[model samples]
Target chain A: MHTEAGPKRPTTPVQKGLQAIPLIINVISANFQLNQFSSLTLLEFALDSSVLLLVGGNRGRCVWATPMNNIIAYLFKSSLGKKYIMAVTGCCLFLFVIGHMVGNLQVFLGPEAINRYGHFLQSNPELIWPARIGLLVFVGLHFWSAMQITLENRAARPVAYANSKPVAASYASRTMVMGGLIVVSFIIYHLLHFTFQCKAINLTGQDFVGFTDPNNHHDIFKMIVVGFNQPLVAGFYLLSMGLLCLHLSHGLSSMFQSLGWKNDAYRPIIDCGAKVVATVIFIGYSSIPVAILVFKFGKEALK
Target chain B: MNLTLKVWRQKNGQTEGHFETYPARDIIEDMSFLEMLDVVNEGLISSGKDPIAFDSDCREGICGMCSLVINGIPHGGHAGTATCQLHMRRFKDGETITIEPWRAKAFPIIKDVATNRSAFDRIIQAGGFVSVNTGGTPDGNALPISKEVSDRAMDAAACIGCGACVAACKNASAMLFVAAKVSHLNLLPQGEPEKHRRALAMVTQMDKEGFGSCTVTGSCEAVCPKEIKLTFIAKLNRDFGVAALLGK
Candidate 1:
């Protein structure tokens, strides 16, 4: 549809047939910036059309547009809409946390293994870049919805009771905001310590980017080993893990409730399962720092 | 028994409120909390002073008219009890007591310990009803509702709308109240036809009323005079999600 001449642009009959669809044409013509049209991948094209279908009204005068607009209004401007967003994003972040913990656990497999895995991920920009952007969007939406809910909650109770007392809400459930804020702070510090390889914040007085494994990949093994070898660093890591545990303990089950996946029959199981999973995650994550700091598992490799 | 009372004294919604201390003398242990208040207010009126004002109806627990936060606990923190049902025997003699109104932006305080809870009526008016034909009462057996379904509906229908759940919730959320109202109708055959519209409209009206969203904190259920379960909120969430996704 664009005037740009690029090899990546679709030329085959099937792709041309797919482009013949009027809705995609409408979305491309109506919404996207002029430059973005040339580089639109199949995934981007599908995602944009669906979003436009829901938001911009169907085909400019389609019969389904009214209900779609109402649904969009409900999702965007209502209390339950904010809740649905939080629960969905919270689920995404929860899955990411599990994946990250599994990836970090690979450090136990020794230098070559973990470094190779890191290299594989780092080298794939096409895959990693999209995943990274999706993750950033999820995090942003999660935190933004949380902030809106928190502020609205505060405004709902403008007058304070003289002697308010909590009856059944757990401490972890009550302190979600506080723990979430701390976890966010830890995420920033963690990205700097490892992902960015910023030496000044690592407190080791040595830059981590220069370190290389025998095969010349970035030595994630050595960086993690040296980083957590310091008691203060490991201690902070442990503390953040504890907060993460607290956050997940309530969040996991609460996510189910918010999404309407929870019911009275499954309440006990969901609640118990959440705590168990949270504890398992804590143990899995904390083991790495403890091994590096206390057991000196990888200290010999540093020399 | 004699007790010192520190009660919230507000002239009206537009004026500032404060605590005015008074001695509650010769209160019998068998008297209800409202009876004790009545005695105290009598003394104030005898002295030609402004008496404490609060809300109460049916002096029994079922009307859901009584709203008070005693010592920071809604409905005196008694399980399955409204403020009217809270007896003086629950308190110790020669002790100090604190009483406040149901505190929430939506349930604005009209006077001392009394609030304007008509916001709830407006919410119910939004979509809490099913369209029925005007006729003589239909035979109950016409709708073959199974025992389990009817019982479940009854459980949700137990909500008294006392506003205690709102008072007990830190966020002053009306989720439990809305959930109960929505579920009782949604589960029944009569309410099935309007289910999607009811869920969508009631929640929209609830948000419009400025109530906070549910944080899944069990505080509302804990202090609910009718002991409405927190699971109903999940039911509402589930229903709302389906209706919204289906564009109903």
Candidate 2:
């Protein structure tokens, strides 16, 4: 659509298609001279138009023509923005944990049920790998943001108060970092125990329980049964589950507040909901080990 | 009440400071905290010693000039009273009370128990006002603001710029203070015209002031003399999100 014959002007079909869009055209004409149109300028122009569209009802032209997308992107660089990122990523991880627990709870149904579920997950590498990658990224963002916030908070109070005391914050809130560290360590150990099936460093020797089903899939039910049968392994899992409870208890409610979803009427309910979810996840995950060891519920599934 | 006072003694912003003990003798229970300090300073001046320096204005606790952290709690850990309103009756006779100034990088100690709080003023300068022309007063009923909205705005406007929120925050965050200003104006109809720009400018200035980020520990609300709610911080976050997305 450009009348100019310059090298930097829009020449691609994408640019031509973008020119056909009315909002982009309005933004381009409003923000730039016709002769100044370029591919980069068109992209910037589209971005500004989309921001206006998203916020709804343009009051007038933006005074500072600096791309608001850049400023909005710049928000994450600030400490408060880091908190927003942490809250968003924490929400993602929280959902994944609940989903993972629900999927694992199928073991209570029977060996065939749990193994079929495992096979269903392993058979679709395409879907599972991307999900795994997304979970990893969320973990990285959550941990990185938490670390940055913690370091900044530590620096904020260089000199410790001789008699510092917490008034409104809970014990879970105060011990978030400590509980988070334990949960991280537990996750690493869990992945090694189940996913990688690494035996060299296996402390409980549950790796000896590995079995293959008729479909040649790993017998996850047998592995879980044998694994939890060890008192040491069961005890460790229970302890880590407690730590996970603490971490999630605070992390869940704090995520809502950080995301600005809290209000006076619903805050107590949200807080109570967080506690319930954490408790349920704790019971759901720890129940498998408890049943395997205490009641031998999955003994028939073992080889 | 005879009391032992261990008060922070700072020379200036550049120098290190420490606590110095002084015996406050025969102090009465009815005396306000600042007035008790006044008595102690009078005795020190009579004895040819430099008097302890502290800040207080409108000792009735309205101006928010009294900034003190008593025994590791901002505003002496009182529920809804400023340091000036805190009375000696709160302490038992012969009790040892430790007092210090508001501690934050943004609020450097100017002297004993007095820090420069101009950082707050700078944040306020950065678009904390409606860009309206000075003119004849409009009728109060012309705007037609709902009582709920007006009351909320007034509640936010109740912030006295005390800087106690900053002192109480574990991160030394000023989010509550900035949120109070932003919500007070943004909730009103007059502030609607400049809402986006105002949120952006004020939050940018707050970050530049070297105050740490808010993690919503709720201590600021707990120690606020005016009882400003943490909900304002959430409202500020919502505004900043919308403003940042919309751009200025």
Native contact fraction, candidates in order = 0.84, 0.48
* Two-chain DockQ for each candidate model: 0.67, 0.54
lDDT of 2 by residue, A11-96 (tens): 56566445335555566665465354555466666666665444331333343244333653345456667778888998998889
lDDT of 1 by residue, A39-152 (tens): 323344565556543444323343322222356556756789888999999999999999999999999999988999999999999989998898999999899889989999
DockQ, prediction 1: 0.67
How would the docking of model 2 be graded? medium
| Interface Cα root-mean-square deviation for all models | 1.0, 1.8
TM-score of every candidate: 0.88, 0.86
lDDT of 1 by residue, B1-248 (tens): 99999999999999999998999999999999999999999999999999899888799899999888898888888889888888999999999999999889999989998999998999999985687867999886888999988998999999999988888888899999999999999999989999998999899888879899998879989888899999999999999989988878
lDDT of 1 at B224: 87
Give the chain B TM-score for each candidate: 0.97, 0.97
CA-only RMSD, every prediction: 7.9, 6.7
Candidate 2 local lDDT, B12-75, one digit each (tens): 8888888899999999999999999999999999999989888888998789899888988898
Model 1: lDDT of residue A124: 95
**Which ranges of candidate 2 are over 4 A from the true structure?**
A1-72, A206-209, A300-303
